[model samples]
Target chain A: MSRTLSNPPSVELLSAVSTFLINDIAPQVNGQSAFHIKVACNILNIVAREIENGADLNESVCEALSNILSDQKTGSDEAQDLQSLKAELSEVIKNDQIKNNAELLDALKMLTLKQLAIDNPKYSGYHQALKSNER
Target chain B: MNAPTDTLIDNSLSGYLERLQTCCRKHFGSQVEVQNLSKLSGGASAETRRFILSDPNKRSSSAVILRTSSIQQGAEFSTSISKDCEAQIQKLCRSKGVPVPEIYFCLEEDDQLGEGYAMSCVEGETIPPKILRKDQYATARENMTDQCAQILANIHKIKPNDTTISLEDQSPLIQLEKLEQLYRQYNQLSPIFELAFKFLYKNAPKKHEITLVHGDFRNGNLVVNEQGIKSVLDWELCHWGDPIEDLGWLCVNAWCFGSELPVGGFGSMDALLERYSYYSGQQVDLEQVKYWQLFGTLRWGIICLFQLNCFLTGLNRSLELAAIGRRVSEVEIDLINLMEAL
Candidate 1:
């Protein structure tokens, strides 16, 4: 975990590739190809962000899920994984098993914010959410 | 004028143009010519093209838009109406004084152009970013909210009985139910979506006056000129539902394109509601519109998933479609914000 590879990391490599596509290749192309290159650049950026923040975000989500499940007295004995916890939480919400739970709402908002941070930090709602969080 | 053999005019496009020329000749007389037929940026449901139709005898030429169903018929989830029906609805909406394009003719099966229609093209900018950022549209931006409100009022004024085409009437709860069903079909779990579904089901607005909803009415769909809105395009999603649905859809953050203004990045919600009330003569409910805004946000997220499913399932291997999957998180954040506000 300390140092598997030296010099440029995955994030740096992805960033370099995205930069190359957008700055170098984009202007050379036109129309649909140009548009797609931009999209490819964006996707690369997202992947880079995911690589950087995905583990921490998932850990935070798992912690939030654990907190919510325990608060609702619905925590399972099997030491559920992130996907299973999310599925359980979804079912809980779907069945209206939890009502007016401020903690649950906050956790969901945090989860969504963390996701937006990875997927598209530039999205207006993500920026707005971050601004509001500051207040 | 003969069709130009430019690089843009590929074999398939040339063949399409030839068939279109024959179709136009049948309607506009033997001397009618089709020129500058180029594909326009369009949604998955339809192929949109712009061309000039000229009548040599009359020495008259007109810009026209040809909107045809994708020949291969890709899975378009929201498009409930056929292209023929869409044309009929546009004609009906025009009769009701809605600012839509003038339909020239609906293509028959024999034309081999697939199901589609040709309409007189109204020139304007439809791109949201340009309209939102450009200084040329400053005055238009000021007036667009009012124009959108009035146009939506006019659109809602057209009663279901007035139109020959059948518009499916789905109440808010029913719409939510259908959306949930569609979301379940993909079998992807998002706790945010689940929470949204729960909130929507609990607080679903009671069905008020059902009217013709311009299902995709937003900043990007409106054709904006220097003066104001020239036309409303993309009627494929039009249906009978809560009239406020259109107003809420207009306010969706995705449509705002990073603008602070909730109403299509042009004006405030209060202004939109006031103008809508003035035009439609119906007092607007702020809560109802907010409900639909939240609903629209969730609906858009599900649509992103659907688009991703299309890519993942190998139905349409489009990078854009795959990229849309990332956009679902944008909607999720918007949904969270909307719910917190409510």
Candidate 2:
């Protein structure tokens, strides 16, 4: 069975990729040739989404990061703090160097804590929302 | 591929040898006989077919191994096999007496062989599981120190030649970039790997003497017997590059085969370095080797991921092959911790 979900690339590549996760991937999947086709198509779709909206996500992430850092400095944007921190994370991970050096290790550590997140059983939803415009 | 022919009559040695006999007579000349084609049952990377053979009018045959990518757990191919380049390296190593397999004849141009060649397979026990066993490896287990150091030193000592020199242009850094490019080409799923790549990039090593590196040199890849280290196998991953890559790979935990022994669970860091330095006329840098180990772990983890994808996604569904892919998470953890320790 294939999942067919699409999110606008610039606004929600993660969302688009995740929305169809059930459609694309099914764990406990046994020996089947179609399993190969599912993974190949899933990866292809993710890449297409990234290509379509990678720049927008990158730019918005950077802008959100700038706002978070600016608010932190002035003590004026506490409300946007957590949300922007998450956005800044998305941006930092977007930065290849930062991801490689500081963030990825941190993320893995965080992931160990959040393994099989109960809140989002789908598991790919955090990065999904980070990339999408609306729920 | 044709379901592997179910071995042969009585599941005996001659079944494989008979097939070899046919190959030799057809390819080499009359009197080409294949004998002692034994199955080297346990290999993490490839299903190794071990054997012996003789040339026409010769009383005895030389020892050799036929390496073919077998259907195994976590084994799948995304890139073209370099059996041809490996044969080329074996040809050179045999000339230099580097303790590597001696290549006699190869079917580099033939498609039926499915990426393999026949080499002067030195007599040895390549069983990693039994290396620590008291009974099976009593003799080879003892000289693990001297044999490992001596053979490793010999591999490092090989002189540069046309085939090796041509590969030097693709330096260690370039190779890393190429690996990253190849992985990314499949698609970027987890950003977790980006962290490892960034760490590698930031900690890139300065250029050094480009020697012929036995790309996958490690304890598991070495052939040992009652006498000691007979030869090193799997030059398929061979290339011209920093020799430290081999040294670093030797230290990887998975290759160590559950032994806490340094470099095949036989020697020490000092022993490995002392031997290498004594032969090369240069001081060995333990620190640089540390960096390469981190690189090694990351590269290995990614390769494992490729294996997992192959099976998990159904490109190849051999459960044994797919299991290797699942273990990538553990390697990823090891790598993260290792870098964190640094």
Candidate 3:
């Protein structure tokens, strides 16, 4: 109960503050300050969402990375952080090793799209990709 | 906390307008009064001030725009050219009948106001959403793609010798290398960006034809009116390079503003290419354009990351810069879509 109590409460607080800023405070300001405050509210909303779903997203990214890099020696590093996994994947890409590998390509595309899904779900390509899957 | 060093400079609007009045007195024999000075938004480094100048004796007033970089202490990424060179480029483009603001004068360093220049302000809607959707700009929106192509063709037609200012040519491959180095300098690994870099390297095009590239020819950068594109603004990124670079950069998905249209949220790529080839008398190469589009997507993605770096490294540190960090993913998704299509 204690573990579950901490995270959602903070996310809820951020959501309330972000909404208040957007709906209430934003209309009272004008010009550059108004635009900036709107951006600030958007940032808070993104942070709130990230707080709610960050752990699951990270685990999904790790699983995707592990599946893609299964052939490499560093693939077995189960304890590798997200940064290390990214570094390993980038090094592999830089060396021209992943060419013509359909599985790795799909893995990379899915992983990047997952990031975009979190960062900007409204992105055109993300919606297009979703539509294609449905078709 | 210490304030930014450049902000300490005299930024008082009245004081700067007085200096502009002194400059105007030299241009026009009679004393002129500056009226209605308002700072336009965007341009973190370059300051765009719109004002009107009137002589007491003469009943008429001219709308003039003054751009100043007095506060930009040092060059950050993207803003690589000087104001003097920008003036020269605009002057040359004006001579060639390219839709550009007429250059008045470049503010000298000795005049006490740090480097900047002034030009006759052309009236038009520069906002993307208005240009894309509003009834006032509907006609301009319809003709934007064709005019954009034709204007770019005319811009690329300018020879290096046409302008007195010596311009550096940044080829597509060289530009990619510089961008990759900047990415590495950030010291953070992005597998998505690395994939894009690798793809670009593998598909790098040979220089099609060396010409003046309107480096930042995109939606927000163009001034459009009811007729069509009134003028092109922001010559800071102008350089000599492959002409298709401009065409490719224009069609980049980032310029689309959530619209399905590939060419600046107004028209189709086929229409752009058709118009461009007709205007420039050069054949369109679809594959090369695609490569540059991919390259442009990656380049824009890196720029976002670079701005985030500017925020994280405490170099600029604004909410706008921090907000731009989120846009890197849009480019990433766009790049992946391009890759899958290829």
Give the top-scoring candidate (TM-score): 1
Q: Which CAPRI tier for candidate 1?
A: medium
Candidate 1 lDDT over residue span B1-342, tens digit each: 001112254246447778999999999899999998877744567877889999989999999988988755578777558998899999988988989999999999899888999998998888788899899999999999999999999999977777667878878888898899999888678888998888889988765887888898998778899988999988988888889899989999988888999999999999999999999999999999999999898998898889889988999887788788888889888988888889
Docking class of 3: medium
Q: In candidate 1, how many Å is residue B283 off?
A: 0.2
| 1 versus 2: better DockQ goes to | 1
**Number of backbone-clashing residue pairs for each candidate, in the order shown:** 0, 14, 0
True contacts kept of each: 0.76, 0.06, 0.65
Better of 2 and 3 by DockQ: 3
Q: Please state the Cα-based DockQ of model 1 relative to the true two-chain complex.
A: 0.57
Let me know the TM-score candidate 2 reaches against the reference structure: 0.64
Q: Which whole-number lDDT from 0 to 100 does residue B315 have in model 3?
A: 82
Q: Measured against the native two-chain assembly using Cα atoms, what DockQ does each of the candidate structures obtain, in the order listed?
A: 0.57, 0.05, 0.54
- The Cα RMSD of model 2 versus the native structure comes to 11.8
Model 2, residue B179: what's the lDDT?
A: 71
lDDT of each: 0.85, 0.58, 0.79
**TM-score of predicted chain B, candidate 1:** 0.94
Model 2 lDDT per residue over B36-86, tens place: 555654334455666666775867667766776554565443332366666
In candidate 3 chain A, where is summed lDDT lowest over 10 consecutive residues? Answer: A1-10
Rank the models by TM-score, top first.
1, 3, 2
Q: Which model, 1 or 3, shows the larger TM-score?
A: 1
Which window of 10 residues has the lowest lDDT sum in candidate 1 chain B?
Answer: B1-10
Scored against the true structure, residue A46 in model 3 reaches a CA lDDT of 70
